[model samples]
Target: MAEENKQIAEQLIEAVGGLENIESVAHCATRLRIMVTDKEKIDQGKVEELDKVKGAFYNAGQFQVIFGTGTVNKIHTEIIGLGAPESSSSEQKKDAAQKGNKIQRLLRTFGDIFVPIIPVLVATGLFMGLRGLLTQEEILAIFGMTPADISENFLLYTQVLTDTAFAFLPALIAWSAFRVFGGSPVIGIVLGLMLVNPALPNAYAVGSGDADPLYILGFIPVIGYQGSVLPAFIAGFLGAKLEKWLRERIPEALDLILTPFLTLLIMITAALFVLGPIFSIVETGIMAAMNVVLELPFGLSGLIIGGLHQVIVITGVHHIFNLFEIQLLADDGFNPFNALITAGIAAQGGAALAVAVKTKSKKLKALAFPSSISAFLGITEPAIFGVNLRYIKPFVMGLAGGAAGGFFAALFNLQGNGMAVTVIPGMLLYIYDFLPFVLYILTNVIALSVAFVLTWMFGFNDKMLDEVNQ
Candidate 1:
């Protein structure tokens, strides 16, 4: 496998205009992200044709070659070993496209910083959903008991698994943000730990009015940052920049000792006294606005967001929505945005499956089948980029399907206990209630049937299938 990856890496190097044209390289869960100096120097078509390369797209100024999951990491490692200077970070690559827009850059930075941390949250979400199932009155009644009758230790174990991540989310986000911003992650982590120090009142209690906020300057309210995203992000960025600024002026002789010590003292103070209070207000307002949007009339919000969600995904701005979903989950114990997003994803899968069934060309069928399955499994890029978008009609049908699913999700007030992961794998997120789980299945089926029927009627033709093969 190593040799095969290196060989593919060699082909990819020459195909992307070699080491000279390449500026930097990185990888995500499924694609090899490359930033090149001159777009015209590389042969995109040839890169697409390379063995094991599923598809290629130029989005937001980055040339992304989809190599699937496990395969991408190996190929990316080989490419880096071949002397292509690695990109400073994935956000840099994401930012190369929208550098002119401040909001875009900030959103990309958040996306890059949080992507690594999402897995833990996803696992916790799944754990929570499963815990709800096992402890449900209905599920337990079948076994002659209720949640109250469950063993104390087993319940405690489940609580630890499901609640620990959210309780210390600030630390995870801070550590990741600092790494992205070029600071010592360990220092960042320590700073994060300080935000949730035992001496301070818990953030949830403060929010719930169970505990009073600490006062600074006799007016500003300082609260511990637990289960908060925006404040941690801001604190991490400032902390990283401060560390860098101090390192430059401090003499090398006593740098190591002084730098870390001073950085922590300064950042910890600012995060507690200044940044925490101000940014916490800002985060609170943002979360309030999201809730209001979700409450919009006749489910118009979900209809529109669901219809355009995949469009945002194509532009790579969809990561910003992850923050919104996380906030919703943290604040309300449910995420309606996740349900809407799942509709969009299932629609993409539906469109791809339609093409796979209808296409006459063996190659197109081969491409569409697995890509559709992948989309159903919560990875939609393959279906979206490699199949549906290649046929514009199917993609349009998908939007219609998505809008339908979203409308119903909103009408039913459908929600999940999690963010990230959708469809097949997403069942873990909705296992909390039998009704919600049934609705989840129906949501996907509605999307699937609508997109499939629409595409079969209008999306493809034998001529397009021939072109696809050629």
Candidate 2:
């Protein structure tokens, strides 16, 4: 495997115009993110055909070659051995700055901020699911106890999982955003601490009217930025720029002492008095817009999201939904969006399986079967890049299946205890609710059946398989 990775890395470096022409290289989740000195010198088609490469595309000022999860990391290490410099902090900031138009840059920044924080959220979400399961009436009966019989310490420990991440979310977001925006992360973290100061009223208390926000200047209200994303992101950007400004003006002798102090003072005051309240409102408006879509009559929201969710995945922007799901779970205790996305994922697997069952090519069948299994495990890239997208018709069939399944999911108001994991891995999220669990399986089955039937009917032929071999 190490030898294979080395060869793939060498091929990748050559395909991207050699180590000399590359400005920087990095990996994120599933792709080799590269910044080249000249795009025309790179052979994109050759990169796509390389062993272990799933797909390749250019977006946000980077050429991204997908290698899935573990493979990308090994190849990345090999690339470093082959003399491609790993991107420095400054290089990352420059790449981020070069990303796209204003809107795309903002979206990309949002993704950068949250991608680092998702694992904790997923772990906590799973704990929440487990907590719910242990406390369920049925489960409690089996244990010969009632919900009240659970120990206080155990319940408190559950809060350690379900509550901690959202509570300190600002710190995480600010730290990442500041790094991405070319600022000192320590200063950003200090600013985040100020935003979520122990002295400030908890955001939930303010929202629930159990406590009042401090009135600043007799009008503006200040509250802890808990479960808030946009505020932290906005504040991080401002703070990073402010720190850079300070670094430029302060003398070297005083830089260490003064830069962080002044940056924190100015940015914290501005966040409390101006940016925090304003961006909080903006965040509310965005969440409201999302709710409007989900609340649309007759499951239209589900049908639309289910039908189109995988398209977002293909573009690699589905991480944005992590923000939405985390916010939803923090505020509402459940996530319907993830439920719909699960349907889409299952549909992809189903369509791939159908193609696997029908194809005459041993290689295509081999790829399709395992990709389908991977999809069922909540990782769909294998099925997507290996099979469905290649055939085109299977992908469309998957979309149709996803729409049908998602329509039913929303119609039943199915919700999960988590955001990230889905399909079999997602079963934990619904195990506490009998009907929702049944509904979850039903949604997958419906997606699989529909996609399987459609793909079997019209998606594959011997001619297509023969062409694929060529």
Candidate 3:
């Protein structure tokens, strides 16, 4: 079976231009993405003939040969060994056109790593940030909770679910990483968990008010990447490699035993001592960069991330930031993720709103209006994929409007610290001293309304209305 599979893999590689014609290879749930220099060079017919290639596709301006779940990476290696080509500008343009896949692949990557256990992350972060706004004394006044309210069983239950995510964020990342990369992320995660766990010995008892402990070389020290990105990513990378090697080489007879044994030994030592801490530092540096971006002139950050937000979502990399946002809520009170997402939804909704007004096709109009409303409520997938993505002018208009909304919203310091929904009004949460909360709210409202109006006025207008009146 292995020999036959290898031969088929080799045949598949040869059909796709001996691998040299290929560029980079990536995969999501259902597809294998291969970037090729000359699309003409690939023998699509021969590739289709391969038993391993369930189906074939060409997308994102890239030549893609689809493969089922675990098969992608194996074939990818065989293809790379056969020789993939280097990328060029024209190739880059083609990949750009395949924007949707790029987004999907990105999200699948991060989501694959994180989605299994995101509810805790989201609910916890939301509670903590919002709770800050409703402190002990404030909670007592607003909700009429006595001092006992702080220790109430209900509150404790809520804290357990939410704080669990925060306290062992890196461990969760490690677990997600394990799913993605297949090493002992469990070890990395546990190491991280121990660091933040109040029950653990000393566990940063040395620190005062967020001075966070940092103990090296003890019980496999791992820099907590809880609510972090880079550290889990790095550990997962190593773990996956180790896991893959173990999966392929370890005997099936002792598979369960040896696989984890080897995986844990290699992954634990590497992650705890190396990847865990190293990537934590890297994560911090990236956060610093994000802070710099956030601190930039209000409209610019909005314009950039807002305009790019939907685009990023399409490529699936947006979840990387979704994870990043969780990290943001964990370490800081305010987060740009929700605010930026609000812009994306509004921008997309504006485009769909135009289509609903302008398209002659009943089908298009039917899809557009409802979809637009959904995006307004913070659900952008349907509008983006079913409407705006299908139409060029509307999408561009939406993007422009989004950029404008983001720019001004950021300018006005409009933010939603908790449970930020997609609707324009969600920005109401950021109102505070030194923040132009009211101004942001008004300007953003104007920007989206104007975008919808302009889209209809210029190209999306009802020509039939005039003819019928005449």
Candidate 1 stretches greater than 4 Å from native: 1-15, 18-20, 23-26, 49-53, 71-104, 465-470
Compared with the true structure, all predictions reach lDDT values of: 0.85, 0.84, 0.61
Which regions of candidate 2 deviate over 4 angstroms? 1-25, 34-50, 77-103, 466-470
lDDT of 1 at 316: 72
How many clashes in each candidate?
A: 0, 0, 19
Residue pairs in steric clash, candidate 1?
none
Candidate 1 has a TM-score of 0.90
Error of 1 at 51 (Å): 5.5
**Candidate 1: tens digits of C-alpha lDDT, residues 1-470:** 78888999999999989999888898887888888888888888788767777688876668889877787889989999999988755555555845336766777777878888889889988998999899889999999997778999998899999888888888888899889899999988988888888789988898788999888789978778888888888889999999999999999998999999999999988888889888888998988887887888897877886788998888777887778877777775788888888888999899999899987877778778988888899888888878888778889999888888888888888999988989999988999989999999988888778888888899877677556546
Listed in order, each prediction's TM-score against the native is: 0.90, 0.90, 0.64
Off by over 4 Å in 3: 1-108, 125-155, 182-225, 247-258, 314-316, 358-361, 389-391, 417-421, 424-444, 462-470
- lDDT string for model 3 (39-122, tens) is 777887677556645446465556656554466667655555545543433344346455546555565567566666656654
